[model samples]
Target: MKKLLNYFFQGLLVVIPISVTIVVIYKIIFWIDGLLPFQLPVKLPGIGEVNIPGLGILTIVVGITIFGYFAKFFVANPFFLLLERLLERTPLLKIIYTSVKDLIEAFVGEKKRFNQPVLVTVNKESQVQRIGFITKNDLTEIGISNQKLAVYLPFSYGFNGQLVIVPSENVEKINASGTEMMKFVISGGVTEVD
Candidate 1:
């Protein structure tokens, strides 16, 4: 009975994560695919003039590529400037919008803030350290202390996180990639950083 239960548990551990990952990817693909003009589609070689699946995704990829090209060269487009000015006027909206935008940019923008993982010393005398992502390397941009760098520490096995600013000297940059570090943090070290 003990061996049988152990095997069952091991099997579950292998199956559940793989199943969830596949299911989530499938759902996300379909959700993005649903964003297209479902009624209109171009004719394909084998499919004829049918509204093929993943057309929406292809459209989005192309649209993003064009947008990125413009944004990279322009730096500050007129449309984006107008939107920023509009958001800044609204007190509540500005705060929410800026925070969300910064978060998104950190993850997938030119800045790529979270790519640098660090070991921050929380207790110097005790030598206590924590792993974190460097969200902001220069606090002076926000008119904060120049000696400090902002880091985001994620909770293990949870979505919760803490944002802190520590002295740059206390942070030792790690060799791990952002994706590997995030996986380790989220899995509470239960999963390997492969």
Candidate 2:
């Protein structure tokens, strides 16, 4: 009975993650598909008009890509800049807008902030350390010491994190990709760092 239980536990370890991942993806695709508002059927070679699943997701992706391309080198760029300026002028909206924009830009913008993963020395006496990303390398403009750097230490199993000011010497650069390190940290170190 113990041997059988061991096998069952091992099986669960393999099956649960895959099952949950598949179900989540399936649900997300259907949710995005439902957001299309109107479904246009396409006629295939042999089959009659058929409504394709996930067409909305495809359309949204293509539309966003096209918009991004145009906005990069067209009149829309100035229009967006003006809109952004107007949003910045508003009191409460400015804070929320800028924060959200900065958060998104930090991850996917041209100047990616989380690319540099570092190991910060939390307790030098106990030789304890914590993993974090260097967000701001320079602090002179902010009146902080140049030797001190801004580090964002993400919490395990959550999207929130705390920012700390650490001495440059106390932070050691880790040789790994940001995405993998983020996954490793978010998974509470349970996921492999490959």
Candidate with top TM-score is 2
The C-alpha lDDT values of all candidates are 0.86, 0.92
lDDT of 1 by residue, 1-194 (tens): 99999999999999999999999887887889876656447788887887655668878999999988887887587888898899988999999998898878888877788798899998899999889998887788789998999999988978779998899999999999998998888988887876
Q: List the residue pairs that clash in candidate 2.
A: none
Predicted structure with the largest lDDT when compared to the true one: 2
**Model 1: number of backbone collisions:** 0
lDDT of 2 at 30: 81
Q: Give the lDDT of residue 173 in candidate 2.
A: 97
Across 7-112, the per-residue lDDT of candidate 2 in tens digits comes to 9999999999999999988899889988888885799988999988778888999999998888788746777879989999999999999999899999999888
Task: Give the residue spans of candidate 2 off by over 4 A.
Answer: 30-53, 75-77
Query: Once model 1 is optimally superposed onto the true structure by TM-score, how far is the C-alpha of residue 96 displaced, in angstroms?
Result: 2.6
| Model 1: per-residue Cα lDDT at residue 74 | 79
Per-model TM-score on C-alpha atoms: 0.69, 0.83
